[model samples]
Target: MLAGAPSSHMSSSVSTSQGIFPTSRIGSGESPNSGASSFTQPIADMNENDETDLLSISWNQDYGCFAAGTSHGFRIYNCEPCKETFRRDLKSGGFKIVEMLFRCNILALVGAVANSHYPPNKVLIWDDHQSRCIGEFTFRSDVRGVKLRRDRIVVVLEHKIYVYNFTDLKLLHQIETLANPRGLCCLSHHSNTFVLACPGLHKGHVRVEHFGLNVTKLINAHDSQIACFTLTLDGLLLATASVKGTLIRIFNTMDGSRLQEVRRGVDRAEINSIALSPNVQWLAASSDRGTVHVFSLRVRVSGEDSLTQPNAFQGPALFHQNSSSSLDPLISPNTGANPNSSLSFMRGVLPKYFSSEWSFAQFHLPEYTHFIVAFGSQNSVIIVGMDGSFYRCSFDQVHGGEVVQQEYVRFLKFENRPK
Candidate 1:
């Protein structure tokens, strides 16, 4: 699994290794507020930064600073007012994956297109203040992803995972898996620490590792290949999707028991991402099909702790009837079983109840069908596209149905300079 806690939650210095990026300071510290009601920006005056394209973006929950990866390098932006306080560009080319360490200057960057200094097969641990890579780790194949916690660093290769100590860069542990090009992994910094989830040796199975306990469990999650997954903030709950994309399953991480499942849709689709809210009360997901669904989650509890209730939560759960009803000419009646769909050719008709599990709320944007999703200020959902555009939408808690949204914030056009 990837890192769960945010960089904003951390202090200025990550570890004794080096200082934080000081050249890119923004007054006291004001990134965009995740709890803001909405951002009313003057888009007409906004201008794109030097970087031409944004390949990846991630937030440091500990620092409230976000790094946007571009062909040149990456820039650090403060969230509240959303300003570009620091910028780092790769003279060689574009960076594919950018993983931020908790509030530390150290960051893991992989997947380079043009830059030779940082190769695609190597993970570069960069110290922002020094503007130099202090350490590097090599892999036999292309590195798919990298993750950082306060104490350790995780790198994901095509089929292998390597864990290293934060200060020494020592190889702590390594895992082998089936073909995992997406670098699907999640880490939970919850009540415990370093709980990880990734694809197992068998397809659709999830290997959950509690690093603190040195224990591992593989859950028979789905029959199809796992698409994407995420853990609750505390690492107690797990949410996963199969290539099928219609169903999203939640499990109790402690015992690998099914907690609950939500439907993304009745038809088959390619899931881009699945995220549980900070509160774990809501789940947001996006698919290449151009739909973002936010479903209300009900986690039953005995007292202060959420209990793991199996089988009782089973059966088709409906978030909504397909928003694009079959009766509507504009809506494709048969999306789940298209012969061209990724897993559509599998035998047998999908259960009629499949249509019942739909997204309670859907973001209808044809252009941003493939965008990445996150929860933002005031529990609003943040949608960012590959083209460098992002939008923030406020979901009504008491009254929820069709998703209500505003125009994209157009991050490329906006710039928050340090004073």
Candidate 2:
């Protein structure tokens, strides 16, 4: 149910809305006090002058670093305690830098380009140790995404999915299915299964393919095109949002049963992106109208036997329940399930041109927000804006407000400045 915006009680300790550059060290590994997320210090943001469309930002597990891809090319960085500069720039209009993976010092950068000519479909693997391109291979169609598994790298094109050996980068097995799968995510935490999202196809859509084996499960899911999807880290739950701005459906990743459906409005808003929390319980989805809707399934005790059953009912199907009662009035939205729903209605929070935030909010100036990418066990979110700026953010811990309070710091400023 809707509760009055949680007692607008702002803790004066870490809350600040005035500084051009603010710094705070949060208690790491989940705060015991307010449940707030702590982050590292805000450093310099990677700046670019061109219209840099952010494709993807991924963490390198092997070297414990991070990398990002934009419209023109891709850059690799070492993001340990401090953010390091880009090791090298692989200059190519690698259309949506789909995925970035690091093994030891080797970083495999893969993305899809819409351009028909000039190396139409290819995967580029760069050796970060040598700081040079090691291998580049062409695919059949535009490569949509590439998942780096322990033993294999799964590549998704327009109509086919290829699993290749990670060491040699050689194609092992190829699977063909529907035409244009919009989004692809590896479901298994151990990297065994993958969830393929193909929006707006006819009956029996949405493929759940078990990697290394030839078994595939297809379900007739969603009314319109499946725009975006993400799986829990344990591969227990799968959330799929529609492109038609209706509702997001969460399903059982194992048996393909419809678990819960979160009904969204049928407005012009499109489900742009969806992200699952590191704990694999809560879900955050953003729309084309620039609102971030967060949902979580709370399991209640229905009966005694319900707990032990193997086919346990997940939970009730609640639609777009707002939890902004804990946000400050200054940033909260006025609609949704909360009285202080103003935060979800803010225009620039979900930028039309771009998405991302940096260390400091440019006061008085308009912001172009675009993409928000998150990482790590704690889900450190980096908001990337259209103007080529990115911000690092952690949600407030203690309060439940109508809006999401972002203690963001300027990280990188991309020049997307026209030449």
Q: What is the lDDT of every predicted structure here?
A: 0.63, 0.44
TM-score of the candidate numbered 1?
Answer: 0.74
In the order shown, the candidates' Cα RMSDs to the true structure are 12.0, 17.5
Which tens-of-lDDT digit does each residue in 1-419 have in candidate 2?
11111123311011112211111211111222221211112232444333455566554432234556655555545433434454322343444553444325444555435323225366655443333445565544566666665466666676666665555554566566556555354534333333333322343257775443445656567766566776554344567765675566766644566765554444556555565554433455555465455544331111111122221112221122143111111221311221123343564675321221111111111222444434333434433334333444444322322333343323345453341
Q: Find the candidate with the highest lDDT and give its number.
A: 1
TM-score, each model? Answer: 0.74, 0.61
Q: How displaced is residue 304 in candidate 1, in Å?
A: 12
lDDT of 1 by residue, 50-108 (tens): 32666777756432456777776666665544566555544467677877754555677
lDDT of 1: 0.63
